[model samples]
Target: MIIEIIGIFFLLLLSAFFSSSETAITRISDVKIYQWGESKNRKYIKAKELMNSRERVIGILLLGNNIVNILASALATSILIGLFGDKGIIYATLIMTTLIFIFSEVLPKTYAIRESEKLILYASPFIKIFIFILSPINFLVQNLVSSILNITNKETKNNDWKQNLRGAILLANNKGDVRKPDRIMLESILDLHEVKVSEIMTHRKNIEGINISENIDLIIDLALKSRFTRLPLWKDNADNIIGTLHVKDLLRARNTNTNLLINDIMQKPQFISENTSLSEQLNNFKKDTVQMAFVIDEYGDLQGLISLEDILEEIVGEIFDEFDKQIAGPEILSDKSVVVDGAMTIRDLNRSMDWKLPDEEASTIAGLVIDIAQKLPSINETIKIDKFHFTVLERQRTRITKINIKLIVID
Candidate 1:
């Protein structure tokens, strides 16, 4: 009886070892580990080439072998039962399951996850050897899987290795190894790849700039009062921004009674379209050594401007300087509508007040009215949008400019 029990114990131990081995292999195979570090790019390239082709096979084998080990445990219990009757079978089965569950599932998986990178590095040579030895079985399994995938429509030409890498990142995030801010920054950086320059630029109306014809005294006052260090100097209107002036230069010229022409103070301004990416913009800023770029439309009209600070703000949220002033929210009228600044961005308005404005030409409240009305509106000239009504409260230079707005129905 003692000998029989010992044999059963040995079989259980073997099964557990195989099970744990399967788990460890499954956990490590899909994980990527660069050979040495980033400095060893050549080694990483070789290691990657060696490991890429066999990952799916490794995963399949790990799952298949784990099942085999689990069944081995059950088979050993059955043999113990046959030889030693009900009580021995019960005891053997309980002991085998407990040992396998703890040693095979929990402990090994924990360690595999913790030392996954190191294990992948150290185990690469062995993994390659195993891949070669199991090539025949791997091919057979691959063919079977391919046939099954064909029936289920799951086969892929590309292997989607990139998604697997992202999944690993997601796994780390799910496991609480990555922090929220880090994840957000990663996502924001990725988003920069898809987003173009046009979406985030300031509009022409929002661009408060000085004309080049302005006097030095006015220019100095404007420079002194300005929040931005670099300001665009236009020829006649905002559309013809010839150059950008540095506030420091304006300060330097303060003692000189001599007239400072825009030409004299102007530095070459870089022009960028709305369609540029944030990443590309950063590169431009580095190359140009300038902090701001004028955003122009295809028609050469000044659309708005974007700054290094603006892009940085998008990444890290709003930044305020000593010159920055807090913007107040729109005044809510007694009639339930609100008086909103025409300069307020639609994005900001919608986010702040829970209003869904139409997403057409205008990003601002004033722009929206002009687009929809097709001309500047007169006082009491109302436009109904959904349940809300807009009444033109002010007009500045042929623009609806500002309005008294409210939602009257469907409250």
Candidate 2:
């Protein structure tokens, strides 16, 4: 009776070990396992192998756990039956079930989930040995399981890489491993493929350029006055952008001879469509060894300009240098009202103020107004959209310069 009781206890403990090991191994991340593998850690390498053949490991664990649990219950019943006769079976069932549920299932699993890394490291060797011993049974079980899944037409969907990456970033943030700004940056990088150059480009209206007709002295003066390193050189008008002139090239020319024409130093402008994805454009920038590109419409009309810095800013937030002018975003006038520049992109305003001003119809706040109003709004003309009021503060002919936005309360 003593030996039988000891054997029952051993089986129960083994059942708990299998249960906890299964839970811990499943919780360990593949990235951490891979890192350990790179360092040639034997336990992690074994863990990785088990993880790779997860179905087999899971099969072995379930088979071993169930077998031990059943044997423990049977042994306990036999011992109780010998002591208490017919009533011993009932007592044995009740006691064994309670013990297994609490000690074998809940307690071990809870600990395993809490300290998954350490549990995986310690449990891996035992798991590998069990896998080797149970290989034949595990293989048959896996085949049967696969056959059943195929018959039921149940297929497991692979996780989307983008969604996985985004989830990982959010998880890191929640764990306090990654700060909010860094999390946002990481998310932005994942979204680069979805973003387009037109969404972040400096609109043609805001572009500062030098006309090729201008003399070297005037061009030098324009370059000195402007904060930009690369300036577009147009032939007759801003619409006819011929090439991009770098300030460094201009300065180099001035040092050699004062009679340098814009054409002499201007590099050919690389033009990209408005619909080009930021990720693709970034690759193009690296492949072509160009820092700036002219964004164009379908008809080959110049829409705006996009630089490498603009694409990078999408991921790393704003990049400001000594030459960058402090262009402020929308100015908050009150709790409900604010003044915003006409050229301010709708996406920028929405992001800064946490507003849901739509950008699908138009890119900029001014353009959105024009798009919704179906015509150019006059100064002081107030347009109501939902609970928000848009009052044009200034207008440049068809273009809006400044506008006051008021969020109306629906009392």
Candidate 3:
């Protein structure tokens, strides 16, 4: 009886060890394991190998854990039966259930989760050996499970790479391993593929350009006074962008010849579709070595202008220069109303003011108002959208210039 009881205790401890090891190893992030593995850490290498075939690892652990647990319970029942007869069976079941639940499942799992990295390093070698020894059983069990799932038409979800990466970044941030700005930048870069050029580009009306028909002296003066390094040169109107004139080119022209024409100094402007993804546009900017590109609609009308700086700002937040005018995001009026530039992007406004104004159908404040109103709104015309009211304060021709927004107070 003593020997049988000792054997049962040994089996139960083995079951608990396997249970804890499984949880610890699987919980360690693959990225961290791979990093350690690359440095030739034997424990991390073994852990990585085990995780490489996760189905096999999990199958082996489950098989071994169950075998030991069942053997321990059987031995306990037999030992107790000899001592107390029929009543021993009932006592054995109750005692084994409580012991297994507390020691094997809850206590070990809690400890493993708290010290996952350290526990994984210690347990991986033993787990790997167990996996190798149980290869045949693991393979059979995995195949059976796969077949069962297939027959039931239940497919396992593949890991989402972006979501995993995002989770890892957020974890790092929460742990204070990554600073807030770095975390935001990393997340913003991930968003580049989803965002469009038109969503962030400076609208056509806001673009600073010189008319090609203007005098060379006036063009030079405009270029010198302008904060932008590159200015668009348009023919007839702002929409007909001919080329981009660099301030450096103008300076070179001034040194070489007093009679500098806009055509002589302007570089051919690169044009991109307004709907182009920011990621693709960024690649194009690098490949072409172009800083600025004219954004056009499907019908070839100028929609806006996008630059390398603009794409970069999407990742690194706004970049401002000494000469760059500081356009305030949104201004608060005396009557508790907020005044915003019509060109302000809906995304920016929502982020700055903590408003839930929709940006799906329109990109800018003006576009959203015009889209909802179904026509150009006259100055001082108030329109209610959701919980907010917007009044057009100023208009440049057909375009909205400034808007006053007020949130409806719920009494």
Candidate 4:
């Protein structure tokens, strides 16, 4: 009877250890584990090994925990039945239930929630040993489970790798292991497949292009003077882009040979729809081994141009070359108002200003204004939307050229 009492109490401690190990193992993030692994620490290496065999580790711990708990319950029942006859059975059941629930389950898990890193590192080796000891049993159990699942013709896979990685990156960012720019770049990579080329491609009006009818000398000079490496070539109209004239190719054609024909040196233009995604365009660029592509509408009219660099810039931010000139930025006035080019994208403004101006319905600042106003705004016309105070400063025919924004503060 004395041995039984002692045995049940010891078994409860073992139950508590298993419960804490389970909680701590699950709570510790992969980011923390990798960070630890960087130190070449044996404990974390073992931790990584345990993480790899988590299914087996969990199975072994659960099996061991249940075995101890059941043994404890039996000893407790035997002791109480000997001490107080039939009613002791009822008392033993109640006492053990309360004791196990509080001391073994709730207390250990709550402590683990706070000390997960330390507890997991400490228990990792023991868990690994237990996993090794129970591998054969775990395999049999896994096969049994699979056989049962096979009856329903079901299959399961861990497709949340992206989600898990995203979470880990975010967690690292929160822990100050990752900087803001790097975090943004990391998240942007996962988002590339979802973003459309039309969202970031240079608009047709902004493209540097020349008519193929121009003199070869003039074309060569424009190619030299222009900042862009690849210039779109038009045959009759600006919208009818025929080919992309590479400045390098043009220079080579001039230096290597006397006859400098633009048509002969120009690369065939690759046309893609405005609705094409950045991921699809990137794959196309890789497959075709092309640097630039011309974006077109449903009617085949040239909408804009997108380059491989543009898609890359979507992840890493703007890429500027030697010839690239600094574009005019927002002019911040004394009254806390900013005047900016209406052609500026809402995404760029939001990023630069750290404002939450919605970019859902429109792409550009001017477009946003037009969307909210439901009309082409006249110069000096002011409108209020949410916390934004929009005042059109400049208008060029049909489009708003420049606008002023004053964010209203709420007390």
The CA root-mean-square deviation of candidate 2, after full C-alpha superposition on the true structure, stands at 4.0
lDDT, model 2, position 148: 94
Models 1 onward score TM values of 0.63, 0.81, 0.84, 0.72
Candidate number achieving the greatest TM-score relative to the actual structure: 3
Predicted candidate 1 versus true structure: per-residue lDDT over 16-87, tens digit per residue: 444444445456443443333344565455456655554564654464445555665666677778778887
The collision pairs in model 4 are none
Candidate 2 regions exceeding 4 Å error are: 77-90, 148-154, 321-411
lDDT of 4: 0.85
Q: Which residue pairs overlap in candidate 3's backbone?
A: none
Steric clash pairs (candidate 2): none
What is the lDDT for 294 in model 1? Answer: 89
**RMSD after CA superposition, every candidate:** 7.2, 4.0, 3.6, 5.7
Give candidate 3 misplaced runs (Cα > 4 Å).
151-153, 171-182, 322-327, 330-342, 349-357, 369-411
A best-first ranking of the candidates according to their lDDT comes to: 3, 2, 4, 1
Candidate closer to the true structure by TM-score (higher is better), 2 or 3: 3
Instruction: Judge candidate 2 at residue 179 and give its lDDT.
Output: 86
Regarding TM-score, does 1 or 3 come out ahead? 3
